[model samples]
Structures are given as C-alpha cells and as structure tokens.
Target: MTMQVRGSKLAARLTASMAALALLGTGAVALAQNWSTTVVASDNGHKVGNPKAKTKLVEFMSYTCSHCADFAREGDAAIKLAYLPKGDVSYEIRHLLRDPFDLTAALLTQCGDPKKFMGNHNAIILSQEDWFEKGRKTTRAQQARWQFGSNGARRQAIASDLGFYELMENRGYTRAQLDKCLIDEAKANALAEASQADVEKYGLTGTPSFVMNGALLDGVHNWAALRPVLDKQR
Candidate 1:
C-alpha cells in the first residue's frame, strides 16, 4: 500500500511538471515573436505592425467613401486584433482624394500630431454618415463660400460651413488649430498632387483599393476576401 501511494504521488508530480514546462514553452514562443510599427518616410501614410512583416498591405481610401468607411469598420478591427498581434503583417493607409470634402477630411486628419493620425482617421471614417448629411443641408451661400475662394480658403470654408470643423471639434480639436490646418495651402496642394500621382501610377478606378506586397489587388474588396490573402502571405 505504501509503495502504491508513493507511485501515485510521483505520477502526479510528473504530470504537474510536464504541464508547467508546456506553459513555459508556450510563453517562450510568444515572447520570441517580434512586433513593431512605424510611420512611412513620406509622412503621407501611417503604417502599423512589424516593419519586417512578411505581408505588407496598403489601402488607398477616400474619407467620403461609404465603401471605404465600411471596410475601415470591419477591416481595421481585424487587422489590429488578429494580424498585427501575430507580428507577421504590416498595414498602411494612403489617401486617394476624390473631392473637396475628401481633401478637407484628409487635411484635418493629418493636421494633428502624427501619433494621432490613425485615431483621427478612424473617427472621421466612422462618423461619415452624420457629417455627410450635414453637408447636404448646406445653403447656396455656404456652397458659394466653399466654391469661390482660393484653394485654401475654399477648403476652410467647406470645413466650417459643412461641419468638418465641428466634427474635429467634437474630436477635441480647437478652432484655432483647425483654422491653421484648413488654410495650409502648401499641404493641401501637396496632398492633391500626391493623390493624382497615385491615380496615374496605379490606374485606380475608385476608392477603397488594396495593394499587397506592392501589387495592386483586383477584386479583393472587403475584409472577408482580403483576410485569406493576408493569411497566405503570412
């Protein structure tokens, strides 16, 4: 009986030791994974996740695009929660301006500190419907204000009259800071030129386009379709 009891106790100890070793091995594997993020050199795109990631994903999106907004809601979440954590994927967003409203939103998003760009971008995209409705309610005078001024002035007018300024304010921006961003002619022109250059280079058809590993992806429009491609690359 004593021998049997000792044998049982030894087996129990062996099982516990094996379990502890397994847990430690799992932790070591997790720790070995390398994850990191950085802003691109151009300062036009914000990148997140491992710089040396096997999969590089880029999105060309317009703020006023409903489809882009949809993708931002679902796709951005999945990237942050799944791919980024795995440390094998990196994601970037480049603006493809579609109109003045898009430019206004883009400028406002980039106007803030670089660290806040993604947060602002996500907020702007998520609140598109509400602000777009406000834009539609603009009076003829408001439209003229947005249409008549110089590029900087016009963009500022559109931002204020169409509620883009108000939207930023809701996001904790001050009027003075936004006014400075709104009237930055050089930045606005640069953004416009860059967007046009991307269009010509990529032969882009519309907003919410995707590029993976430097190849423009065709027919891969949503997270459901794109997720599998990312997995394969990983």
Candidate 2:
C-alpha cells in the first residue's frame, strides 16, 4: 500500500508538470504572433496586420490635416494592440496629398527601409502641429523655394524649413538618406498619382476617410465612430 501511494503521488506531480508545460507552450505561441509588428509597404499605402484578414480597414489620410492627425493619435494604438494581434483585421493607411507641404511629408514617410514606414508615418502625423506652426511662419523666400524648384528641390526646401529634418532625425534617419528619398521623382509622381486615383476611386472628398472591406464608410471619420464599427466586426 505504501508503494502504491508513492506511485500515485509521483503521477500527480508528473501531471502537474505537463499542465505547466502546456501553459508555457500556449504562451510561446502567443508571443510568436507577429501580426502586430509585421509591416509592409503597398502600392501607395503602408499596411500592418495579416494580409489574409477578413476585415480590411483602409484609412485615407493627409499629413497636413489636423483631423487625420487626431485619428492617428486616438485610433492607431488600440487597433494595433487589439485587432491586429488577432489577425482578423488589417489596417492600411493611404495618403491623399493635398498640397506641396503634404506631398513633402508623404515622401518622407516612405523614406528608408520599408519596415520603417509605419514608424515614420506615425512620427509625421502625430507631430504635424509642430511643423505646421513652423510652416505657417515661413518666410516668403522659403515658400518660393517650396513652390518653384524641381520636385526634389522643392520638397527638400519644405523639409528643411518646416523642421521635418529634425523630426526624422529623431527617428534615426540621416539627412543624406532622407534627401535621396525626397529626390526620387518616380516615387514622388507615383505617390501623387496614386493619391489622385484613390480620391476618384473611393469618392474621397476630404481627409481622414475610411474604407472597410471594400465599402467606403461615409461619415465614419473619427475614433469614437470607428470603435463601435470595429467591435461589431468580430
């Protein structure tokens, strides 16, 4: 009887060990999920989350728009944390360039590695005010430089004058690398052309528009309105 009792005790210990291992395996699987961190550059947009996700959320935003900035601050964190990790929802941000200043900033967002696009995009949009103030106070000389020069030169002028150089430098980009991206005429024209194409294709009339699962979400522009829709999606 004593030997049988000891065997039962050992079996209980072994069962507990297996349970703990199972729990650890579950945690490892969770940690291995890269849906949230995986970022990719699309045609004229930057996307994050599982490409195969059923619910595709596309945001048409402009760097120069305050409302777009507001959405970036309020909505991005939750979406990245909640929806993206589940691999059920994907978020893509498309630029709708409205002006030279907007196009200048958009070019900078596409600078450097494709993996860095999301961070660069968030940096520009969230810090829009800091640069907008500087843009407002720019000298006529600076404005002329932005408007009349070659595509790259004009954007380069905007970047220098609006404190964007300082902004991107904070993100660990050197001036030379950034200038190279700024001067890429092919990229500039592509982004601009894509922006116009999106405007017409989606009937986008303003900044901070939304398209979910191929249907444009009219009047659903801000976080408060969007959260409910996301919650109902899954």
Candidate 3:
C-alpha cells in the first residue's frame, strides 16, 4: 500500500511538470510571431500586415473629412490589436484628395519613406481640428494663395497657412524635405487622379468608405459596422 501511494504522488508531479512545459512552449510560439508591425507601400498608399493575406481591407479616406479621422481613432486600435497580428488580414488606407487641404495633408503623410507614411498620416489626421480651425479663421487674402498661382506655390501657401508645416516638423521632418514633397506636381497630380479613379470605381458617396477583398463593403462606414463584416470574413 505504501509503495502504490508513493508511485501515485510521483506520477502526479510528472504530469504537472509536462503540462507546464507545454504551456511555456505555446507561449513562446505566440511571442515569436506577430505580423502587425509589417508595412508595405504602393503607389498611392501604404498597406499593413501580410502581403498575401486572404482578406484585404481598403479604406478610402480624405484628410479633409472629420469622419475619416474618427475612423482612424477608433478602427486603428481595434484592427491593429485584434486583426493585424493574425497575418491573415491586411489593411490599406487609400487617399481621397478632395481639395488642396486634403492634398496638402496627403503629401505630408507621404513625405518620407513608406515606413513613415502611417505615423505621418496619424499626425496629420489627429491634429486636423487645430489646423482646420486656423484655416476657417484665415482672411480671404490669406486663403487666396492656396487656390491661385503655380501648383508648387499654391501648395506651399496652403501648407504654410494651415499649420501643416509645423505638424510635419514636429514629426521630425526638415523644412526643405517637406517642401519638396508638398510641391511635387507629379506626385500631387497622381494622387488626384488615383482618388478620382477610386471614387468612380467604387461609386463612393462619401469620404469614409471601404473595400474588402476587392469588393466594396456597402453602407459600412464606421468601426462598429466594419467589425462584424471583418469577423464574418475571418
């Protein structure tokens, strides 16, 4: 009877040790892999997550639109935390250049390398309230420079008056580099044309729109609505 009891106690200890080892192995696997930090750039935008993800989500957002900013605030945390780490889904925020304000912000976001796009993007979008208010207070004379003159001159005027220059400067960009990006007629025109194409292609009615798996996710604008659709795809 004593021998049987001792053997039972030893078996229990071994079983517990094996389970703990299994759990540690699983944790190591989880810690070793997370694809959320990856980002790739396309001509008109930056993409995040696995390049060949089964589910691709595209957001058509304009810097001038408040709703787009709201999405950035809400959707970013949810998607980056929950979905992007999985490596099965991808996200891209495509530009919708509505006006010079939109174009200026987009140019600033696209200023540095591809890796800088999202950080620059959030910087501009999150601070829209301040610069937009400044724009509203500007005199007609001040606003005129944004609309009239050469393309580079008009872009420069808008950037200066709206505080975009200061925003990018805070993001570690030099004045000369920001100016070069802001005045690139070719890049600006390409952005404009791409936005136009997306608008027509999607039959989009507003600034905050979505495309999922190459199909437009109709009537889904905010994060709340977007969540269910992404879950279903997963």
RMSD of 2: 2.2
Among the numbered candidates, top TM-score falls to 2
lDDT of 3 by residue, 85-190 (tens): 8788999989988888888888889887888888898998988898889988999999888778998888889889988888889989999999999889999999
Candidate 2 deviant stretches above 4 angstroms: 1-20, 23-27, 31-34
The true-versus-predicted C-alpha distance at residue 195 of model 3, in Å, is 1.1
Candidates by lDDT, descending order: 2, 3, 1
Please, what is the whole-model Cα lDDT of each candidate in the order they appear?
0.82, 0.91, 0.89
Runs off by more than 4 Å, candidate 3: 1-31
Clashing pairs in 2: none
Query: Which ten residues in a row are the worst by lDDT in model 1?
Result: 34-43
Residue lDDT tens for model 2, 7-90: 999999999999999999999998788698888898898889998999999999999889999999999998999899878999
- Judged by lDDT relative to the true structure, which candidate is superior, 1 or 2? 2
Model 1 clash count equals: 0
lDDT of 1 by residue, 1-234 (tens): 999999999999999999999999999998876444344434456787777778888899998889999999999977877788667788888899888988888889887777677778877899888888888898888888877868778888888776777778887899999989988888888888988988888788887889888888998878788888887876
Which of the two candidates, 2 or 3, achieves a greater TM-score against the reference? Answer: 2
Query: Where is model 3 poorest over a 10-residue stretch in terms of lDDT?
Result: 31-40
